[model samples]
Target: MKNDSTPITKSRGPAEHEVRAQIVAAATEHFSHFGYEKTTVSDLARVIGYSKAYIYKFFESKQSIGEMICGNCLREIEAEVSAAIGQSDQPPEQLRRMFKACTEASLRLFFRDRKLYEIAASAATERWQTVIVYEANIQRLLREVLQAGRLSGDFERKTPLDETTMAIYLVMRPYLNPLLLQYSFDYTEDAPVQLSNLVLRSLSP
Candidate 1:
């Protein structure tokens, strides 16, 4: 008996995924190098040796590809933060590691495709919402990590955990500039060291 409502069972297939991954990898590289405005569908197709219509079969448009890339970056950052937290034995250390991991993840994503980020930033009209959602999700993940630290007595916070988390996010947001900027940079070698000190000092013992 054939069931018309049965969903296709292709989720575990490697070939389909590999093709899609290749497409995304090509698109990511193109977008990072050429940016959204400067990048075109033809460029992506040509790079991957696929026709324009073939690329369309996988991605509806360049914006769709950008959205997927942003999603991938967020997922990677989330995974890094999770792995750092999982590896730390001390709650306080976990808190410190979480911040450092977040910073590292941000730098990796920004540097992975510098031009793409610039394009996403510049095309406020196209990618503004996507970027906002990406950042907001990261903040939520960070807030959850902070809440865990507070629960473990690692964080001695007089202020609400949510408030403190928001403050931290605000402070670190500016640090992304050096990661994105190409010229002379004022490196914050002690950023993690300072963050650990600030958080421990602020928290109740």
Candidate 2:
């Protein structure tokens, strides 16, 4: 007689997560090669060797996958910047390092998954109003850094801290924007150096 009471083996949670990750990897490649407007869910599904319905089970749609991919990129930036910000005792140095990390991280991570970058860049162009809202939040975070520096007497500016922060962001905009970097003169060697020099000079008492 068999032991009918034995429990059935469940699907491993790690395996499920691995599947989800593979789906994202495949989607990123498809989007990068073809760009957002030209890619289709079927393409992603085919590359991953999964049915469209199964892919939908992991993600509701292609846009949903794009959001996840972009969110992963942002999280990486946040983590690196947060660490650099925390490590320095000097406010000006912290600000300088943060900007450097932001620029480098954006370049490295943005190009890592090319298809996703193309898709996101195209979508952002068409939906800039929404993109501005996201950008505003990032600007606000930078404002807080400026406020801290002002309180520390590390930065002296006639304008409000928020305004100064916005100006700093505007200055860095072209260097930080991936699309702009592709067209602009290469600053790979000097962008961070020039940025730090400008910040240091502007903030000196």
Candidate 3:
């Protein structure tokens, strides 16, 4: 799902955007209530009071709805990280804050809307467009932070920037990857700050 706008394919009849919105709104509540895994397209149609054929006009499968919902949640987490990064000028501090904010926001999501987490796992495993874009944004953020760090001598210039950025992403992946995050969550209580500090020390010039 595109973050800015939901794309509408060619259609006839009622406004396609509106219909999709209606379906999505109903589906959102339904997924939250009944959870995503067991809910079938038929179940969703019944829950939303629409025929399965009507729903199929907008979404090809149940996974599409879950992808959109999961996309929105990933965007929310990205927004939290961006806000955290903006709060500090020092690259090292920004990096630490990015980790901290991401972990906190995701943990809050985990505790509050676990069904979404399952959707995320599915999205990640499927390598959906939403997941691809989400990961790219994260890597972009890391590259920016590292570029600033190198300029400020907060990080070493010996390593290639791409390599450094990738290494950092890999280090943070366990907490970031929803497929593995719940498993990683147990050790993450104090790990965000601690891990960031360790990475910062290694980056220090």
Candidate 4:
């Protein structure tokens, strides 16, 4: 005799992409408020209405979530940099605008979300490769501006492009580094203008 047992169907969960997005979103909120060291997988899972195991399914660890958040913040800054560069026809003006935009974006993000700044600082130390790649990309953008200025006679090209790029990066480090701004609170207000002036002057023909 055939038994009348019904087959049990497992419930379908959120799509992998959806799950990852949700995890990132919840993690962003947690990281923004509580910081990387304080925020845990359990905290994120609780905020997202998921189990820690569920969060783990999407993110390997809390650090992974912090990395994702830092990546998002960097992308936003990159976009701002691109937009600032696009707004000007003159290379020197473009460089100034880019500096202003990037500095402002960094300051805004740092002040608005200190926890996010903590994540960035941690990423710079722990996720060195990722931070290096981002720094390279920014330098590339600066190199483009420098090259354009050289062609337009807006900047003196006595130094090599790579050298000039590195110099600019060094000179602008205080303005660009969130941790530095956090410590040098007095400089925070005047950094964009002061740093941009210094950079533009260094680039001038």
Among the numbered candidates, top TM-score falls to: 3
lDDT of 3 by residue, 23-134 (tens): 8788888877778887899998997899999888878788887777777677788888888899999999999998898788877765477765677777788888777878
Clashing pairs counted in every model: 3, 3, 0, 0
Structure candidate 3, residue pairs in collision? none
In order, candidate lDDTs are 0.64, 0.67, 0.80, 0.73
**Per-residue alpha-carbon lDDT of candidate 1 for residues 74-151, written as tens digits (9 for 90 to 100):** 556667777887786666776677677767776666666668766545533454445566556657666766777777
Query: Which candidate leads the pack in lDDT?
Result: 3
Collision count of model 2 = 3
Comparing 1 and 3 on lDDT, the stronger one:
3
Candidate 3: what lDDT? 0.80
Q: Could you arrange the candidates by lDDT from highest to lowest?
A: 3, 4, 2, 1
Stretches off by above 4 angstroms in model 2 are 1-22, 32-35, 57-60, 112-114, 127-137
Span of ten consecutive residues with least summed lDDT in model 4: 1-10
Question: Mind giving the per-residue lDDT tens digits that candidate 2 earns over 44-97?
Answer: 888889998888777766766766566556556666666777778778777777
Question: Looking at model 2, which ten-residue stretch has the lowest summed lDDT?
Answer: 1-10
lDDT winner between candidates 2 and 3? 3
Clashing pairs for model 2 are 31-115, 32-114, 32-115
The TM-score that candidate 3 achieves is 0.89
